[model samples]
Target chain A: MTIYLPIAELSVNIFVILGMGAAVGFLSGMFGVGGGFLITPLLIFYNVPPVVAVATGANQVVASSVSGAISHFRRGTLDIKLGLMLLAGGLAGATVGIWIFSFLRRLGQLDLVISLLYVIFLGFVGGLMLIESINAIRKTRKGVVPVKAPGQHPWIHRLPFKMRFKKSKIYLSVIPVIGIGFGIGVLTSVMGVGGGFIMVPAMIYLLRVPTNVVVGTSLFQIIFTTAYTTVVQAATNYSVDIVLAFILMVAGVVGAQYGVRVGQKLRGEQLRALLALLVLAVGIRLALQLVITPADVYSLAIGGVHG
Target chain B: MKRALLATLTLLGLVAASPAPAFAQALSPPAQGSVVERLEIGMNTSQIAITPDFAGADLAIFGAVVNADELLNSIGQYDIVVTLEGPKDFATVRRKERVFGIWINRHSVTFKEAPMSYTLSSTRKIEGEPGVPPLDAPGIGIQHIDLTPTDFLRGGRLLEDFRDAYRRLKMESGLYQPDPGGVRFISSTLFQANLKLPANIPSGTHTVRAALFKSGKFIMEKTLPLRVVKTGLEQAITDAAHQQPLLYGMASVFLALLTGWGASVLFRRD
Candidate 1:
């Protein structure tokens, strides 16, 4: 059956949207990633307006993050204090990001900027993940346990505004933590992603947060950042389609439960390798689109006349 | 302007004075010697309510041609063309250029006012026939439609290219459809046609025009007004989003938070 989306002003098959939501949700649950990076592109492929897709994708991320965060909270793995600090930075970054988005939109360069950002960020993150996972897998096969370094680098130690995070049992300068949060916030606002992929690694490598708490903390901050983005996009751009978001979130929530169960049976390196492949695959597809000539060189867009 | 106003008033007075039966008879072709032909048209529905489940709509236009000359009727040369045009809106077309190995929008042209969607159906092929009136003769096909560029870009050398691009893109999106032989005649005087509206048809007031031609020459034309509007939940949501965007945005955020919190609560494990 087909249903018309009000804000997007398009008719889409119910089953197709549901399936898309479930599939992305499952990956998000298993990998502890926001999946907006996946959903936004898929929506674009399905011909949803780019603005609507990004806004609605951010709305969906809020639901999945909440669902994932609750479980981690119950397990006592969340760093609430750290998450709040990161959220403060993220909010400020999102504001600046939205301003930039508006300026780019006025200049009719939003689509190009968004596509280029996706290609660059996805390529970098996906490439790094693929290499690390492959190396970890090779080490396991050779019967060698990987060792982690504990001490902070000189630059990180020298930063001002140091604070202690009790849950992760770490003392770190707030400057870098806020900077990371700000970067993720900008990405979340522009790309409609939860930025967990970047956040998890930053927390692990830079801040030396406990691996077990990283996912929870990232999710905790993501829920707020995405929520803010959703509201801002809706108010300023009027692009958020609540019905589309609702359908995706409902299916995503259920799929996430199943994903968590399945994740328990998989080895860490194997899961990471699989996720790395998925990320790289998406990144390559985006890169190829940039290089290949489009079927129609000319495109039409509705003028920016606010209703 | 005064003369036009007087003419319109006189026409309205004639309509008001005529009875229902007289009005019907008045539309018939003029007696024997007159070269004029009379056309009467009706639509299945004048207003289309777009609900949440609305995929698309098929519009049926039925009409009759009265007093077509014997020469035209015998030769099977009478043609009927029906067109439906949506409200005009500003549109922008952009061409992408390869810059630094990445495609970026380089050139753009903006149309001041263009139909958001247009559908045309004709009894016979609109083009490629000798002596047949061109589709854009006056009030016929899309070619005849007046598309003006924005004031700043008017009279530019590249105007034709931009117009062609706009038409091409609209066609690709199924917003502009021109189907030949779409209208069929049941008998000499009576004809009907169906216009298929795409799922993405914009909501607005549309004008439907039916024109009659004899021996490849335009004779008479009639226009009907139509309304395509969103109804029910779809209407409500769109209105809120556009009219009260701030409140709508806040509600959307609140709803998301509530849904997330509710899901967590429901699925929480002790």
Candidate 2:
């Protein structure tokens, strides 16, 4: 069946959209990621306008992150103070990101910029995760316990305005926390992601936050940032497709439930390796589109999207 | 008395061939040696209310030639061209070039007040006949539709390229459609023009123009206004997005929250 997306102003196969949502939701659930990184690119590949895809991607992230946040809240793994600090930064970054998005749109360069950013971030993150996971697998086979060396603070610790996060048992600068939050917030709006993939690693490696609290705190911040981005994108760009988002959210939540059960059976390093490969594949596909010669160089835009 | 009679004949001849902006027009096969031509055009429906299942619509417009020369009409020397022009707005056409190993939109040209969609239909070909020249009016056919550039109109032939690209893209996308033989004569003086309205046709006040040409020379023209409005679910969503954007945004967020919250509750871990 074909369903019309009111904001995208296009009719797409309902099954295709549902399958995409379900697939992405399953992966996010298995890996404990928000899945916005996957959904936006998938929607773009399906011929949804980038504007609508990005805006609606953020909206979809809200639903995908909600259950995870609630689970963490019940377990007391979430750090409310840290999440709030990140929220302050994220909200500001989203505002800036929206302005930048509109500016690139008018310049007719939004598509190129979006593709480039995705390729760069996805490639870097995927590469790092793959190498890290492979080494972890090797260590497991050798029967060596993987341990993190503590009491080592990098130059980031010297920054002023430091505050103690009792839940994470760390004293970190608010500036870096806000800065990371701001970056994630910007990505939420521009790329239509919850920034969880980036945030999870950043907290563990950079801030040295405990692994137990990282996923929960990241989810907490992502929920608000993506939700804020969705509302703002709807108000300003008017690009959010409620029909498309709803369908995706429904399929995603259901898929995640099944994914979480399967995830429990898989080993951690193997799961990370699999996710790394998937992310790399998506990045490479986007990179190829950037360098490939277009069938037609000239494009017509009448009243934005031609009749 | 003989000179006075000669003067009256000359005045009558001038009136027959003179431009008749006031004359109503239709789209049928035009005939040569016109004595006098007056065109009147009307549509089957005044407005098209697009329902949710609207794929597209083929509109039939009826027009007639009043006071047409009988001999010329019989000879098929007349051609009728009917065009449907959608709401106008400034449009931008962009061209991509490979820049530093990446394809990027490098150049852009803006057209001044171009119609969002253009549908043309005519009896015979609008650009018909080997010896006979095409219609002189610029607004008569798809190719002749005005697409004057807003800027970057240097003496180079580049402007022509941009204009051609714009039209070709529009045609390829079904925005600018043309049917060479869509107009047919139901009777000796009455003709009907069939215009194919694409599903993505802009909703607003559109203008349907019917121009009459006798022996490839413009005789008269007529215009009618058409309204295309979206109805049902599509209309409500579109209106809410544009008119009440803030509320629409809030509602969208609320929906997301509800969906997320509802899912978590339904599959709660007991």
Candidate 3:
């Protein structure tokens, strides 16, 4: 069945959209990662206009983050103070990012910028995850626990404007927290991603945020950031299609449920390895499009009417 | 002042009408015939309401050729070419070039006041052919549609390539369609011209035009105003997004919140 997307102004196969949502949702659930990184790229591949895909992806992340955050809040695994700080930065960053988004769009280079950012970020993150997971798998086979040595009194400890996060049990500088949040906020606006894939590792390793509280904190900030992005994108760009977003959200949540169940049966290191490969695959695919010659060089955009 | 041609049109296309005849004059010099051959078209409705599931629709333009010569009618000398031109807008076409091993849009040309969509239905191939009167001239067929660059001379001499690319792309996108045999002659005086409204047809005040040709010579033409309006949920959504954008944005966020919260609550019960 074909359904018309109001904002995108395109008719797409309903099953194709539903399947994409379900598949991305399952992976996010299984991998414990927000699926923004996957869904935005997938939507672009499906020929959804980049503007619509980006805004809709941000909207999808809002739902997933809300659910993910709720679980963490129930378990008391989140640092509210830290998450709020991140949000403050995220809100400001998102505001700036929208300006950049519109500017790039007017320049007609928004699509190129989106693809380049995705290729760079996804490639870096995927390669790091692959190497780390492979090492972890090797360590487990050798009967050694792969425990990371916690660094104390690191350079981050000397930064000014330091505040204590009681829940995370860390006295971290507000600068890095806000900075990371700001970066994620910009990503949410431009790329329509929750930034959890990057934020999770940053929280765990760079900020030295506790593992238990990291996912919850990241998700807490994500819910608001993506929500804000959605609202702003609609207000400015008017690119968010509620019809498209709703389908993806419903299918994604249902798929995530099954994914969580399957995730329980898989080992941690292997799961990360598989997810890494998936991320790498998506990243590489986007990269190829940039280098390869396109079928049609001349493209048209009707100005002032969805131009 | 272009010319006071005795053509029939409700809207002006560089056509000034005299008291005797009004509007829709072709590019050709006004035909001075002993008997004025006039074309008339009637629309069932002024507006076509498109539903959310509107893929594409066929608009049947029923018209009559008034005062046509009997000899011309008997010998198939009269050819009718009908077209539906969509609302006009500035359409920009961009060309991509490989830069530093990556292809990017490097050049662009915008057609000023170009019709957003166009569908042509004619009695036969308009390009002059044997046994049939050719109506394809400076202002008749799809190829004859007027398209000028915004910066006509600034692009220097490379504007023609952009124009060609624009037409090819539009045709490929199913926006510019030509049906040579779409218009059929039910009778000599009366004809039914079937124009296909593409799935992506722009909603606006479209013009239904019928140009009459007698023995390959241009006569008076006729035009009618047909509004294409998107209706139902699709229209409602588009309106809300543009009109009450803030409210629409809030509603979208609220919906997402509800969906997310509901999912979390449902899963918790399980």
> TM-score per candidate, in order?
0.86, 0.81, 0.84
- Candidate 2 Cα misplacement greater than 4 A, ranges: A3-5, A27-49, A71-82, A95-121, A149-175, A186-194, A208-216, A259-265, A304-307, B1-35, B129-133, B152-155
CAPRI level of candidate 2: acceptable
Q: Candidate 3 chain A: minimum summed lDDT over ten consecutive residues — where? A: A146-155
Among all windows of 10 consecutive residues in model 2 chain B, the one with the lowest summed lDDT is B22-31
State which candidate has the highest lDDT.
1
Off by over 4 Å in 3: A30-49, A75-79, A96-118, A149-153, A158-171, A187-194, A208-213, A259-268, A305-307, B1-33, B129-134, B153-157
> Which structure is stronger by TM-score: 1 or 3?
1
lDDT of 3 by residue, B59-166 (tens): 898988876555446767778888889999988888889989998888888888888889999888888678544564557776777877776454655787888888
Residue A289, model 3, lDDT: 76
Task: Tell me which of candidates 2 and 3 scores higher on DockQ.
Answer: 3
Candidate 1 deviant stretches above 4 angstroms: A100-121, A150-152, A189-194, A262-275, A305-307, B1-33, B130-133, B151-158, B265-270
Q: Model 2: per-residue lDDT, tens digit, A1-307?
A: 6666666765677789889878876765555577776788789878676778888887887776665666556566678899899889988987888787767767766667787978998899889878887888889899988776433567898899999998888998999999988887777666656767777766766787765566668767877777777877888888888888989988876776556556555676676677678778778977987788989999766555321
lDDT-sorted candidate list, best first: 1, 2, 3
Candidate 2 on B1-270: residue-level lDDT in tens? 453344345434545655564332322233244235689899999898776555678899999987666545787867799999999988878888998999887888888889989999988677767965666666677777788777744426877778889999888878799898899999988999999997667778999999988777788899999998777787788889888877887787788677767766787854
TM-score: which candidate is best?
1
- Please identify which of the two predictions, 1 or 2, would achieve the higher TM-score against the true structure: 1
- Reproduced native contacts, each prediction: 0.60, 0.58, 0.61
Q: Which ten residues in a row have the lowest lDDT in candidate 3 chain B?
A: B1-10
